[model samples]
Target: MGATTVLGLARRAAVGVAGAMGLTWVVRAAWGIPSAMGASVSAIAPVAVASARYRNRQFHNTEPSTQVAPGSAVSLLLSALTRQGVGRPLGAIPLATPEVPERAGALAVTWYGHASVLVEVDGYRILTDPVWSERVSPSPVVGPARLHPAPAPLSELPPVHAIVISHDHYDHLDRETVRELVRSQDAPFVVPIGIGAHLRKWRVPERRIVELDWGASYCLTGTGPGADDLVITCTEARHFSGRGLIRNTTLWASWVIAGPTRRVYFGGDTGYTTAFAAIGATSGPFDLTLLPIGAYDVHWPDVHMNPEEAVRAHADVCGGEPGYGLLVPIHWATFNLAFHGWSEPVQRLVTAAKAAGTTVAVPLPGQRIDVNALSPQVPWWEDVRRQ
Candidate 1:
């Protein structure tokens, strides 16, 4: 091509790139800015600030957890730049169409990918971290998108007794999902301290919102609805929270869901912490445990747990016998959030579970695992990604 033609082509390419970037910025501004930003700090802070975990206007983990260390940005950048197939699956991931019966079994869990789950504990249904939107970000157009489609639509889900939110991070607390749930379902949203402000900003009714600081509990009753008097307690998680520039303005937590007969422990997202055993002693010996087993890195060990850590946490939650509770891993296989091989999380989890004598159910996204009749540990993820 002639020099003039080449120069013209380059100029057009540059302009196109610039235009794309500008459009992205505009979309983020219009859609990414959370409606909850201006939520009442008083509504969120009073209880949290009073807790021992609260200090300096932020929440802290019982066991000092760190998000990132000094001079780690260079390593993160390097990892991102050099990362090759680490963030994606080699083959298509299989999804399952979960069957939600009219009444949930004694104790069951439907893994909807990542941290989202539908727990059926002693006939009550609790949906945890339901992120049905395409992306888990402030802007639908600009965040970590789902790797696989949700097996079923939100409307398809059966009536849940309650919706439990762990924190205010974009991934765990999605605005659109919450809005739709408000319109469709009558169940109350149970969240950590201060997260109620975000829900209020999103127009969730005050009656349908229940906020609690760590160690607080809500008893639901009626003998016919809302878990028939199931108890949910906000428990400590070793992590930080933020939906925007302000970090720890809200609280992050794990949860203890106790029914009359069975109990479930949800380890939302956390680094390995010393409080696990304490949680077990206070409110555990759970029949089922949903824990994070993905998005772990050597540098940020204090934020997300590895598979091995998850197993250890499971045993702690089970009060010693790791094999006592049914384990279903979460926070992995749904999005490309970290620099690890797509299947590495489960692989490590299976190995660790076996070593720890913990029984784990590796259900495909949307697949439900009845904690009692637990299926054999089939390496389903391996079927897709051949070595």
Candidate 2:
């Protein structure tokens, strides 16, 4: 009995020391949230407990039934651990050529990174999912850190008429970026329901934030009302959302911007669901479709679409033809959020799109390829990946 008691005491002391060191390391990490580490622990602990309870009680809960594959978990951990070692050349990367001056009256889109894009339609600019943070995690010290620096500072962006957010995921809705935007720009913030709570938490003015549910239409004229003709409507996205602690307490969404001349759809992260076809049947025949093509794996097939599904999604939204309009792939090249090789998503997308006779454009990050311009096949990611 005495021997067992002594062993238990020693084990407890060792565990306590290791835990203290871990806490110190997390608190002192170079990333952003030096002060909020304690708060993060409190926030996430309750959610984890709730998840456990829900899993036990709910019949709808699905757990990973199969055993974890060999080396899969190890690879994920090492990729995350050595994020900085990958060595992305930030300075040598080229900036995208702006097409705004060329396409004065037509709609144009400039992708910042991930789902963040600047869409200029009929002279009115709409910014979507603008994440300017260095990392996309609830905690700055850990989680999927960004591979490359932002192409341009958020402050350097031109005057945007409006800003749109798809969901409340850390990558999709960054708090720091939101605060900076609220202070820097005069544009009204458009987002799905419950995401406004986050903006309010960050002290954004109530009048500047507009929350919309699925199928709700909000009109946007030019600078002044009726200066230009454009209407933006919040549509549904088959995804989930949460920030800090709460999961799916908010909503995820897509947007349909109908210009006088053409209609466009932004499928803000979603799986391959029948909703796309329904959306097409209702407000589509889109001239252009911006789709996600990365951060997908077989494990979460119902959450994010792969490259092939992206092509099919484009066909469902736009007409089922290649030359019908244009398919510009977004949600990649900005951040390394997936387990696959960095360039694999676009390479696979290009091949699948070609087989389907779809006209796809893989623009370099920050580069703009005008739909009206005669596009030349410039495979830029090949050399970058080889490097």
Candidate 3:
């Protein structure tokens, strides 16, 4: 073979190798970006900046709050390193097969763990902060994975009248789950301010997205016999939000779901705050209150609620008395998100509720209980705690 012919072949081989390398790099970069990390702050800021929470180019809690206090990283790091089984149950978390009644008259709550719940109020179903994905993270291969299987598949869920999203946190708002629901369900999504951007990014239809600022309410049209329809109000919560490094471009909220006969409150992830009393007075007197009872620590004091705080918030929302409504504890027993013992939240909550003369339901994942049947509380976590 001639030397020039050999050189030509070598040049072609080098070009092919370079082309393949370029293609691989491109694929890696694109694959790293997931819909789990939704819209950027800048992309959604115009809508967010209109709210009272939005100021100085970021959203703020009603009161001055610190999400993570200075120099607390040391304790957090030590806890994360030394804690062995603090974050998960000793035994497998129990599951309940939900038999949703054809129609709920007063109210009923079906808890799906980690802040996901289905509230059947006056014959309409409202789903809250549903996380059906395997893990709550931007990466498919990493992040916090579920400790137990979902009580039931999303496809098995009953027809919902509306889906309420409290915030944009990955654990509450999942990418794959949201995409699947958009394709399968006809229910519109009622979300806090600026969360619609994320839904839009996932190709959810504009007509089906209802975004409300704090203190605003949207009435579900054609869902009631009378003029009074199912009204969902965006209420205050002392928390922050972010899908990426930057935080609080979108508002976080607790919610009020008011049916003709039954009223419910969904306390999304939040720190202890006084907004509960105002919520109670303004749009509450809830028949059932669903609140977070885990993933709380002194380090991040102004975000997640402890069990005691959750009980307090529930009373404050339902009226000054815990007897006003049934309290269903959520945001635990599904993922290992904090340094507390797996059963600690339920244990503490039961004690608190009893002291306050409040009725509490500690349902296992997928347990559906009628709010009016709140007596003889079940200690489902005790088996797991012993195991």
- Tens-place lDDT per residue, model 1, 65-175, is 678866799898899788844878878899988988878889888989889999988888899999898887776577788889988989988888899999888789888
Give the Å shift of residue 364 in candidate 1.
0.6
List TM-score per model, in order: 0.91, 0.78, 0.90
Among all candidates shown, the one with the greatest TM-score: 1
Tell me the deviation in Å of residue 150 in model 1: 1.0
lDDT by candidate, in order shown = 0.86, 0.72, 0.85
Candidate 3, pairs of clashing residues? none
Query: Per-residue lDDT for 1-387 in model 2, tens only?
Result: 699999999999999999999888877564455322112333333333333222332211122222223447766576668653343433334456444453344667777778888887667778889988887875766666666567678877887878988877778888788889988998989987666666766778988888777788888755566566688898867676655444555667889988887788998887776778778888878877899998786545667889999999988877454556678888876676656667778899999998888888777667665566736979877777666
Question: How far out, in Å, is residue 30 in model 3?
Answer: 8.4
- Show model 1 residue runs off by greater than 4 Å: 1-25, 36-43, 225-228
lDDT of 3 by residue, 43-109 (tens): 7988887887788878888888887878898887888799845787778888998776766545888
For model 1, what is the error of residue 202's alpha carbon versus the real structure, in angstroms, after optimal superposition?
A: 0.2
For model 3, give the 10-residue run with minimal summed lDDT: 220-229
Candidate that beats the other on TM-score, 2 or 3, i.e. the better one: 3
The better-scoring model by lDDT among 2 and 3 is: 3
lDDT of 3: 0.85
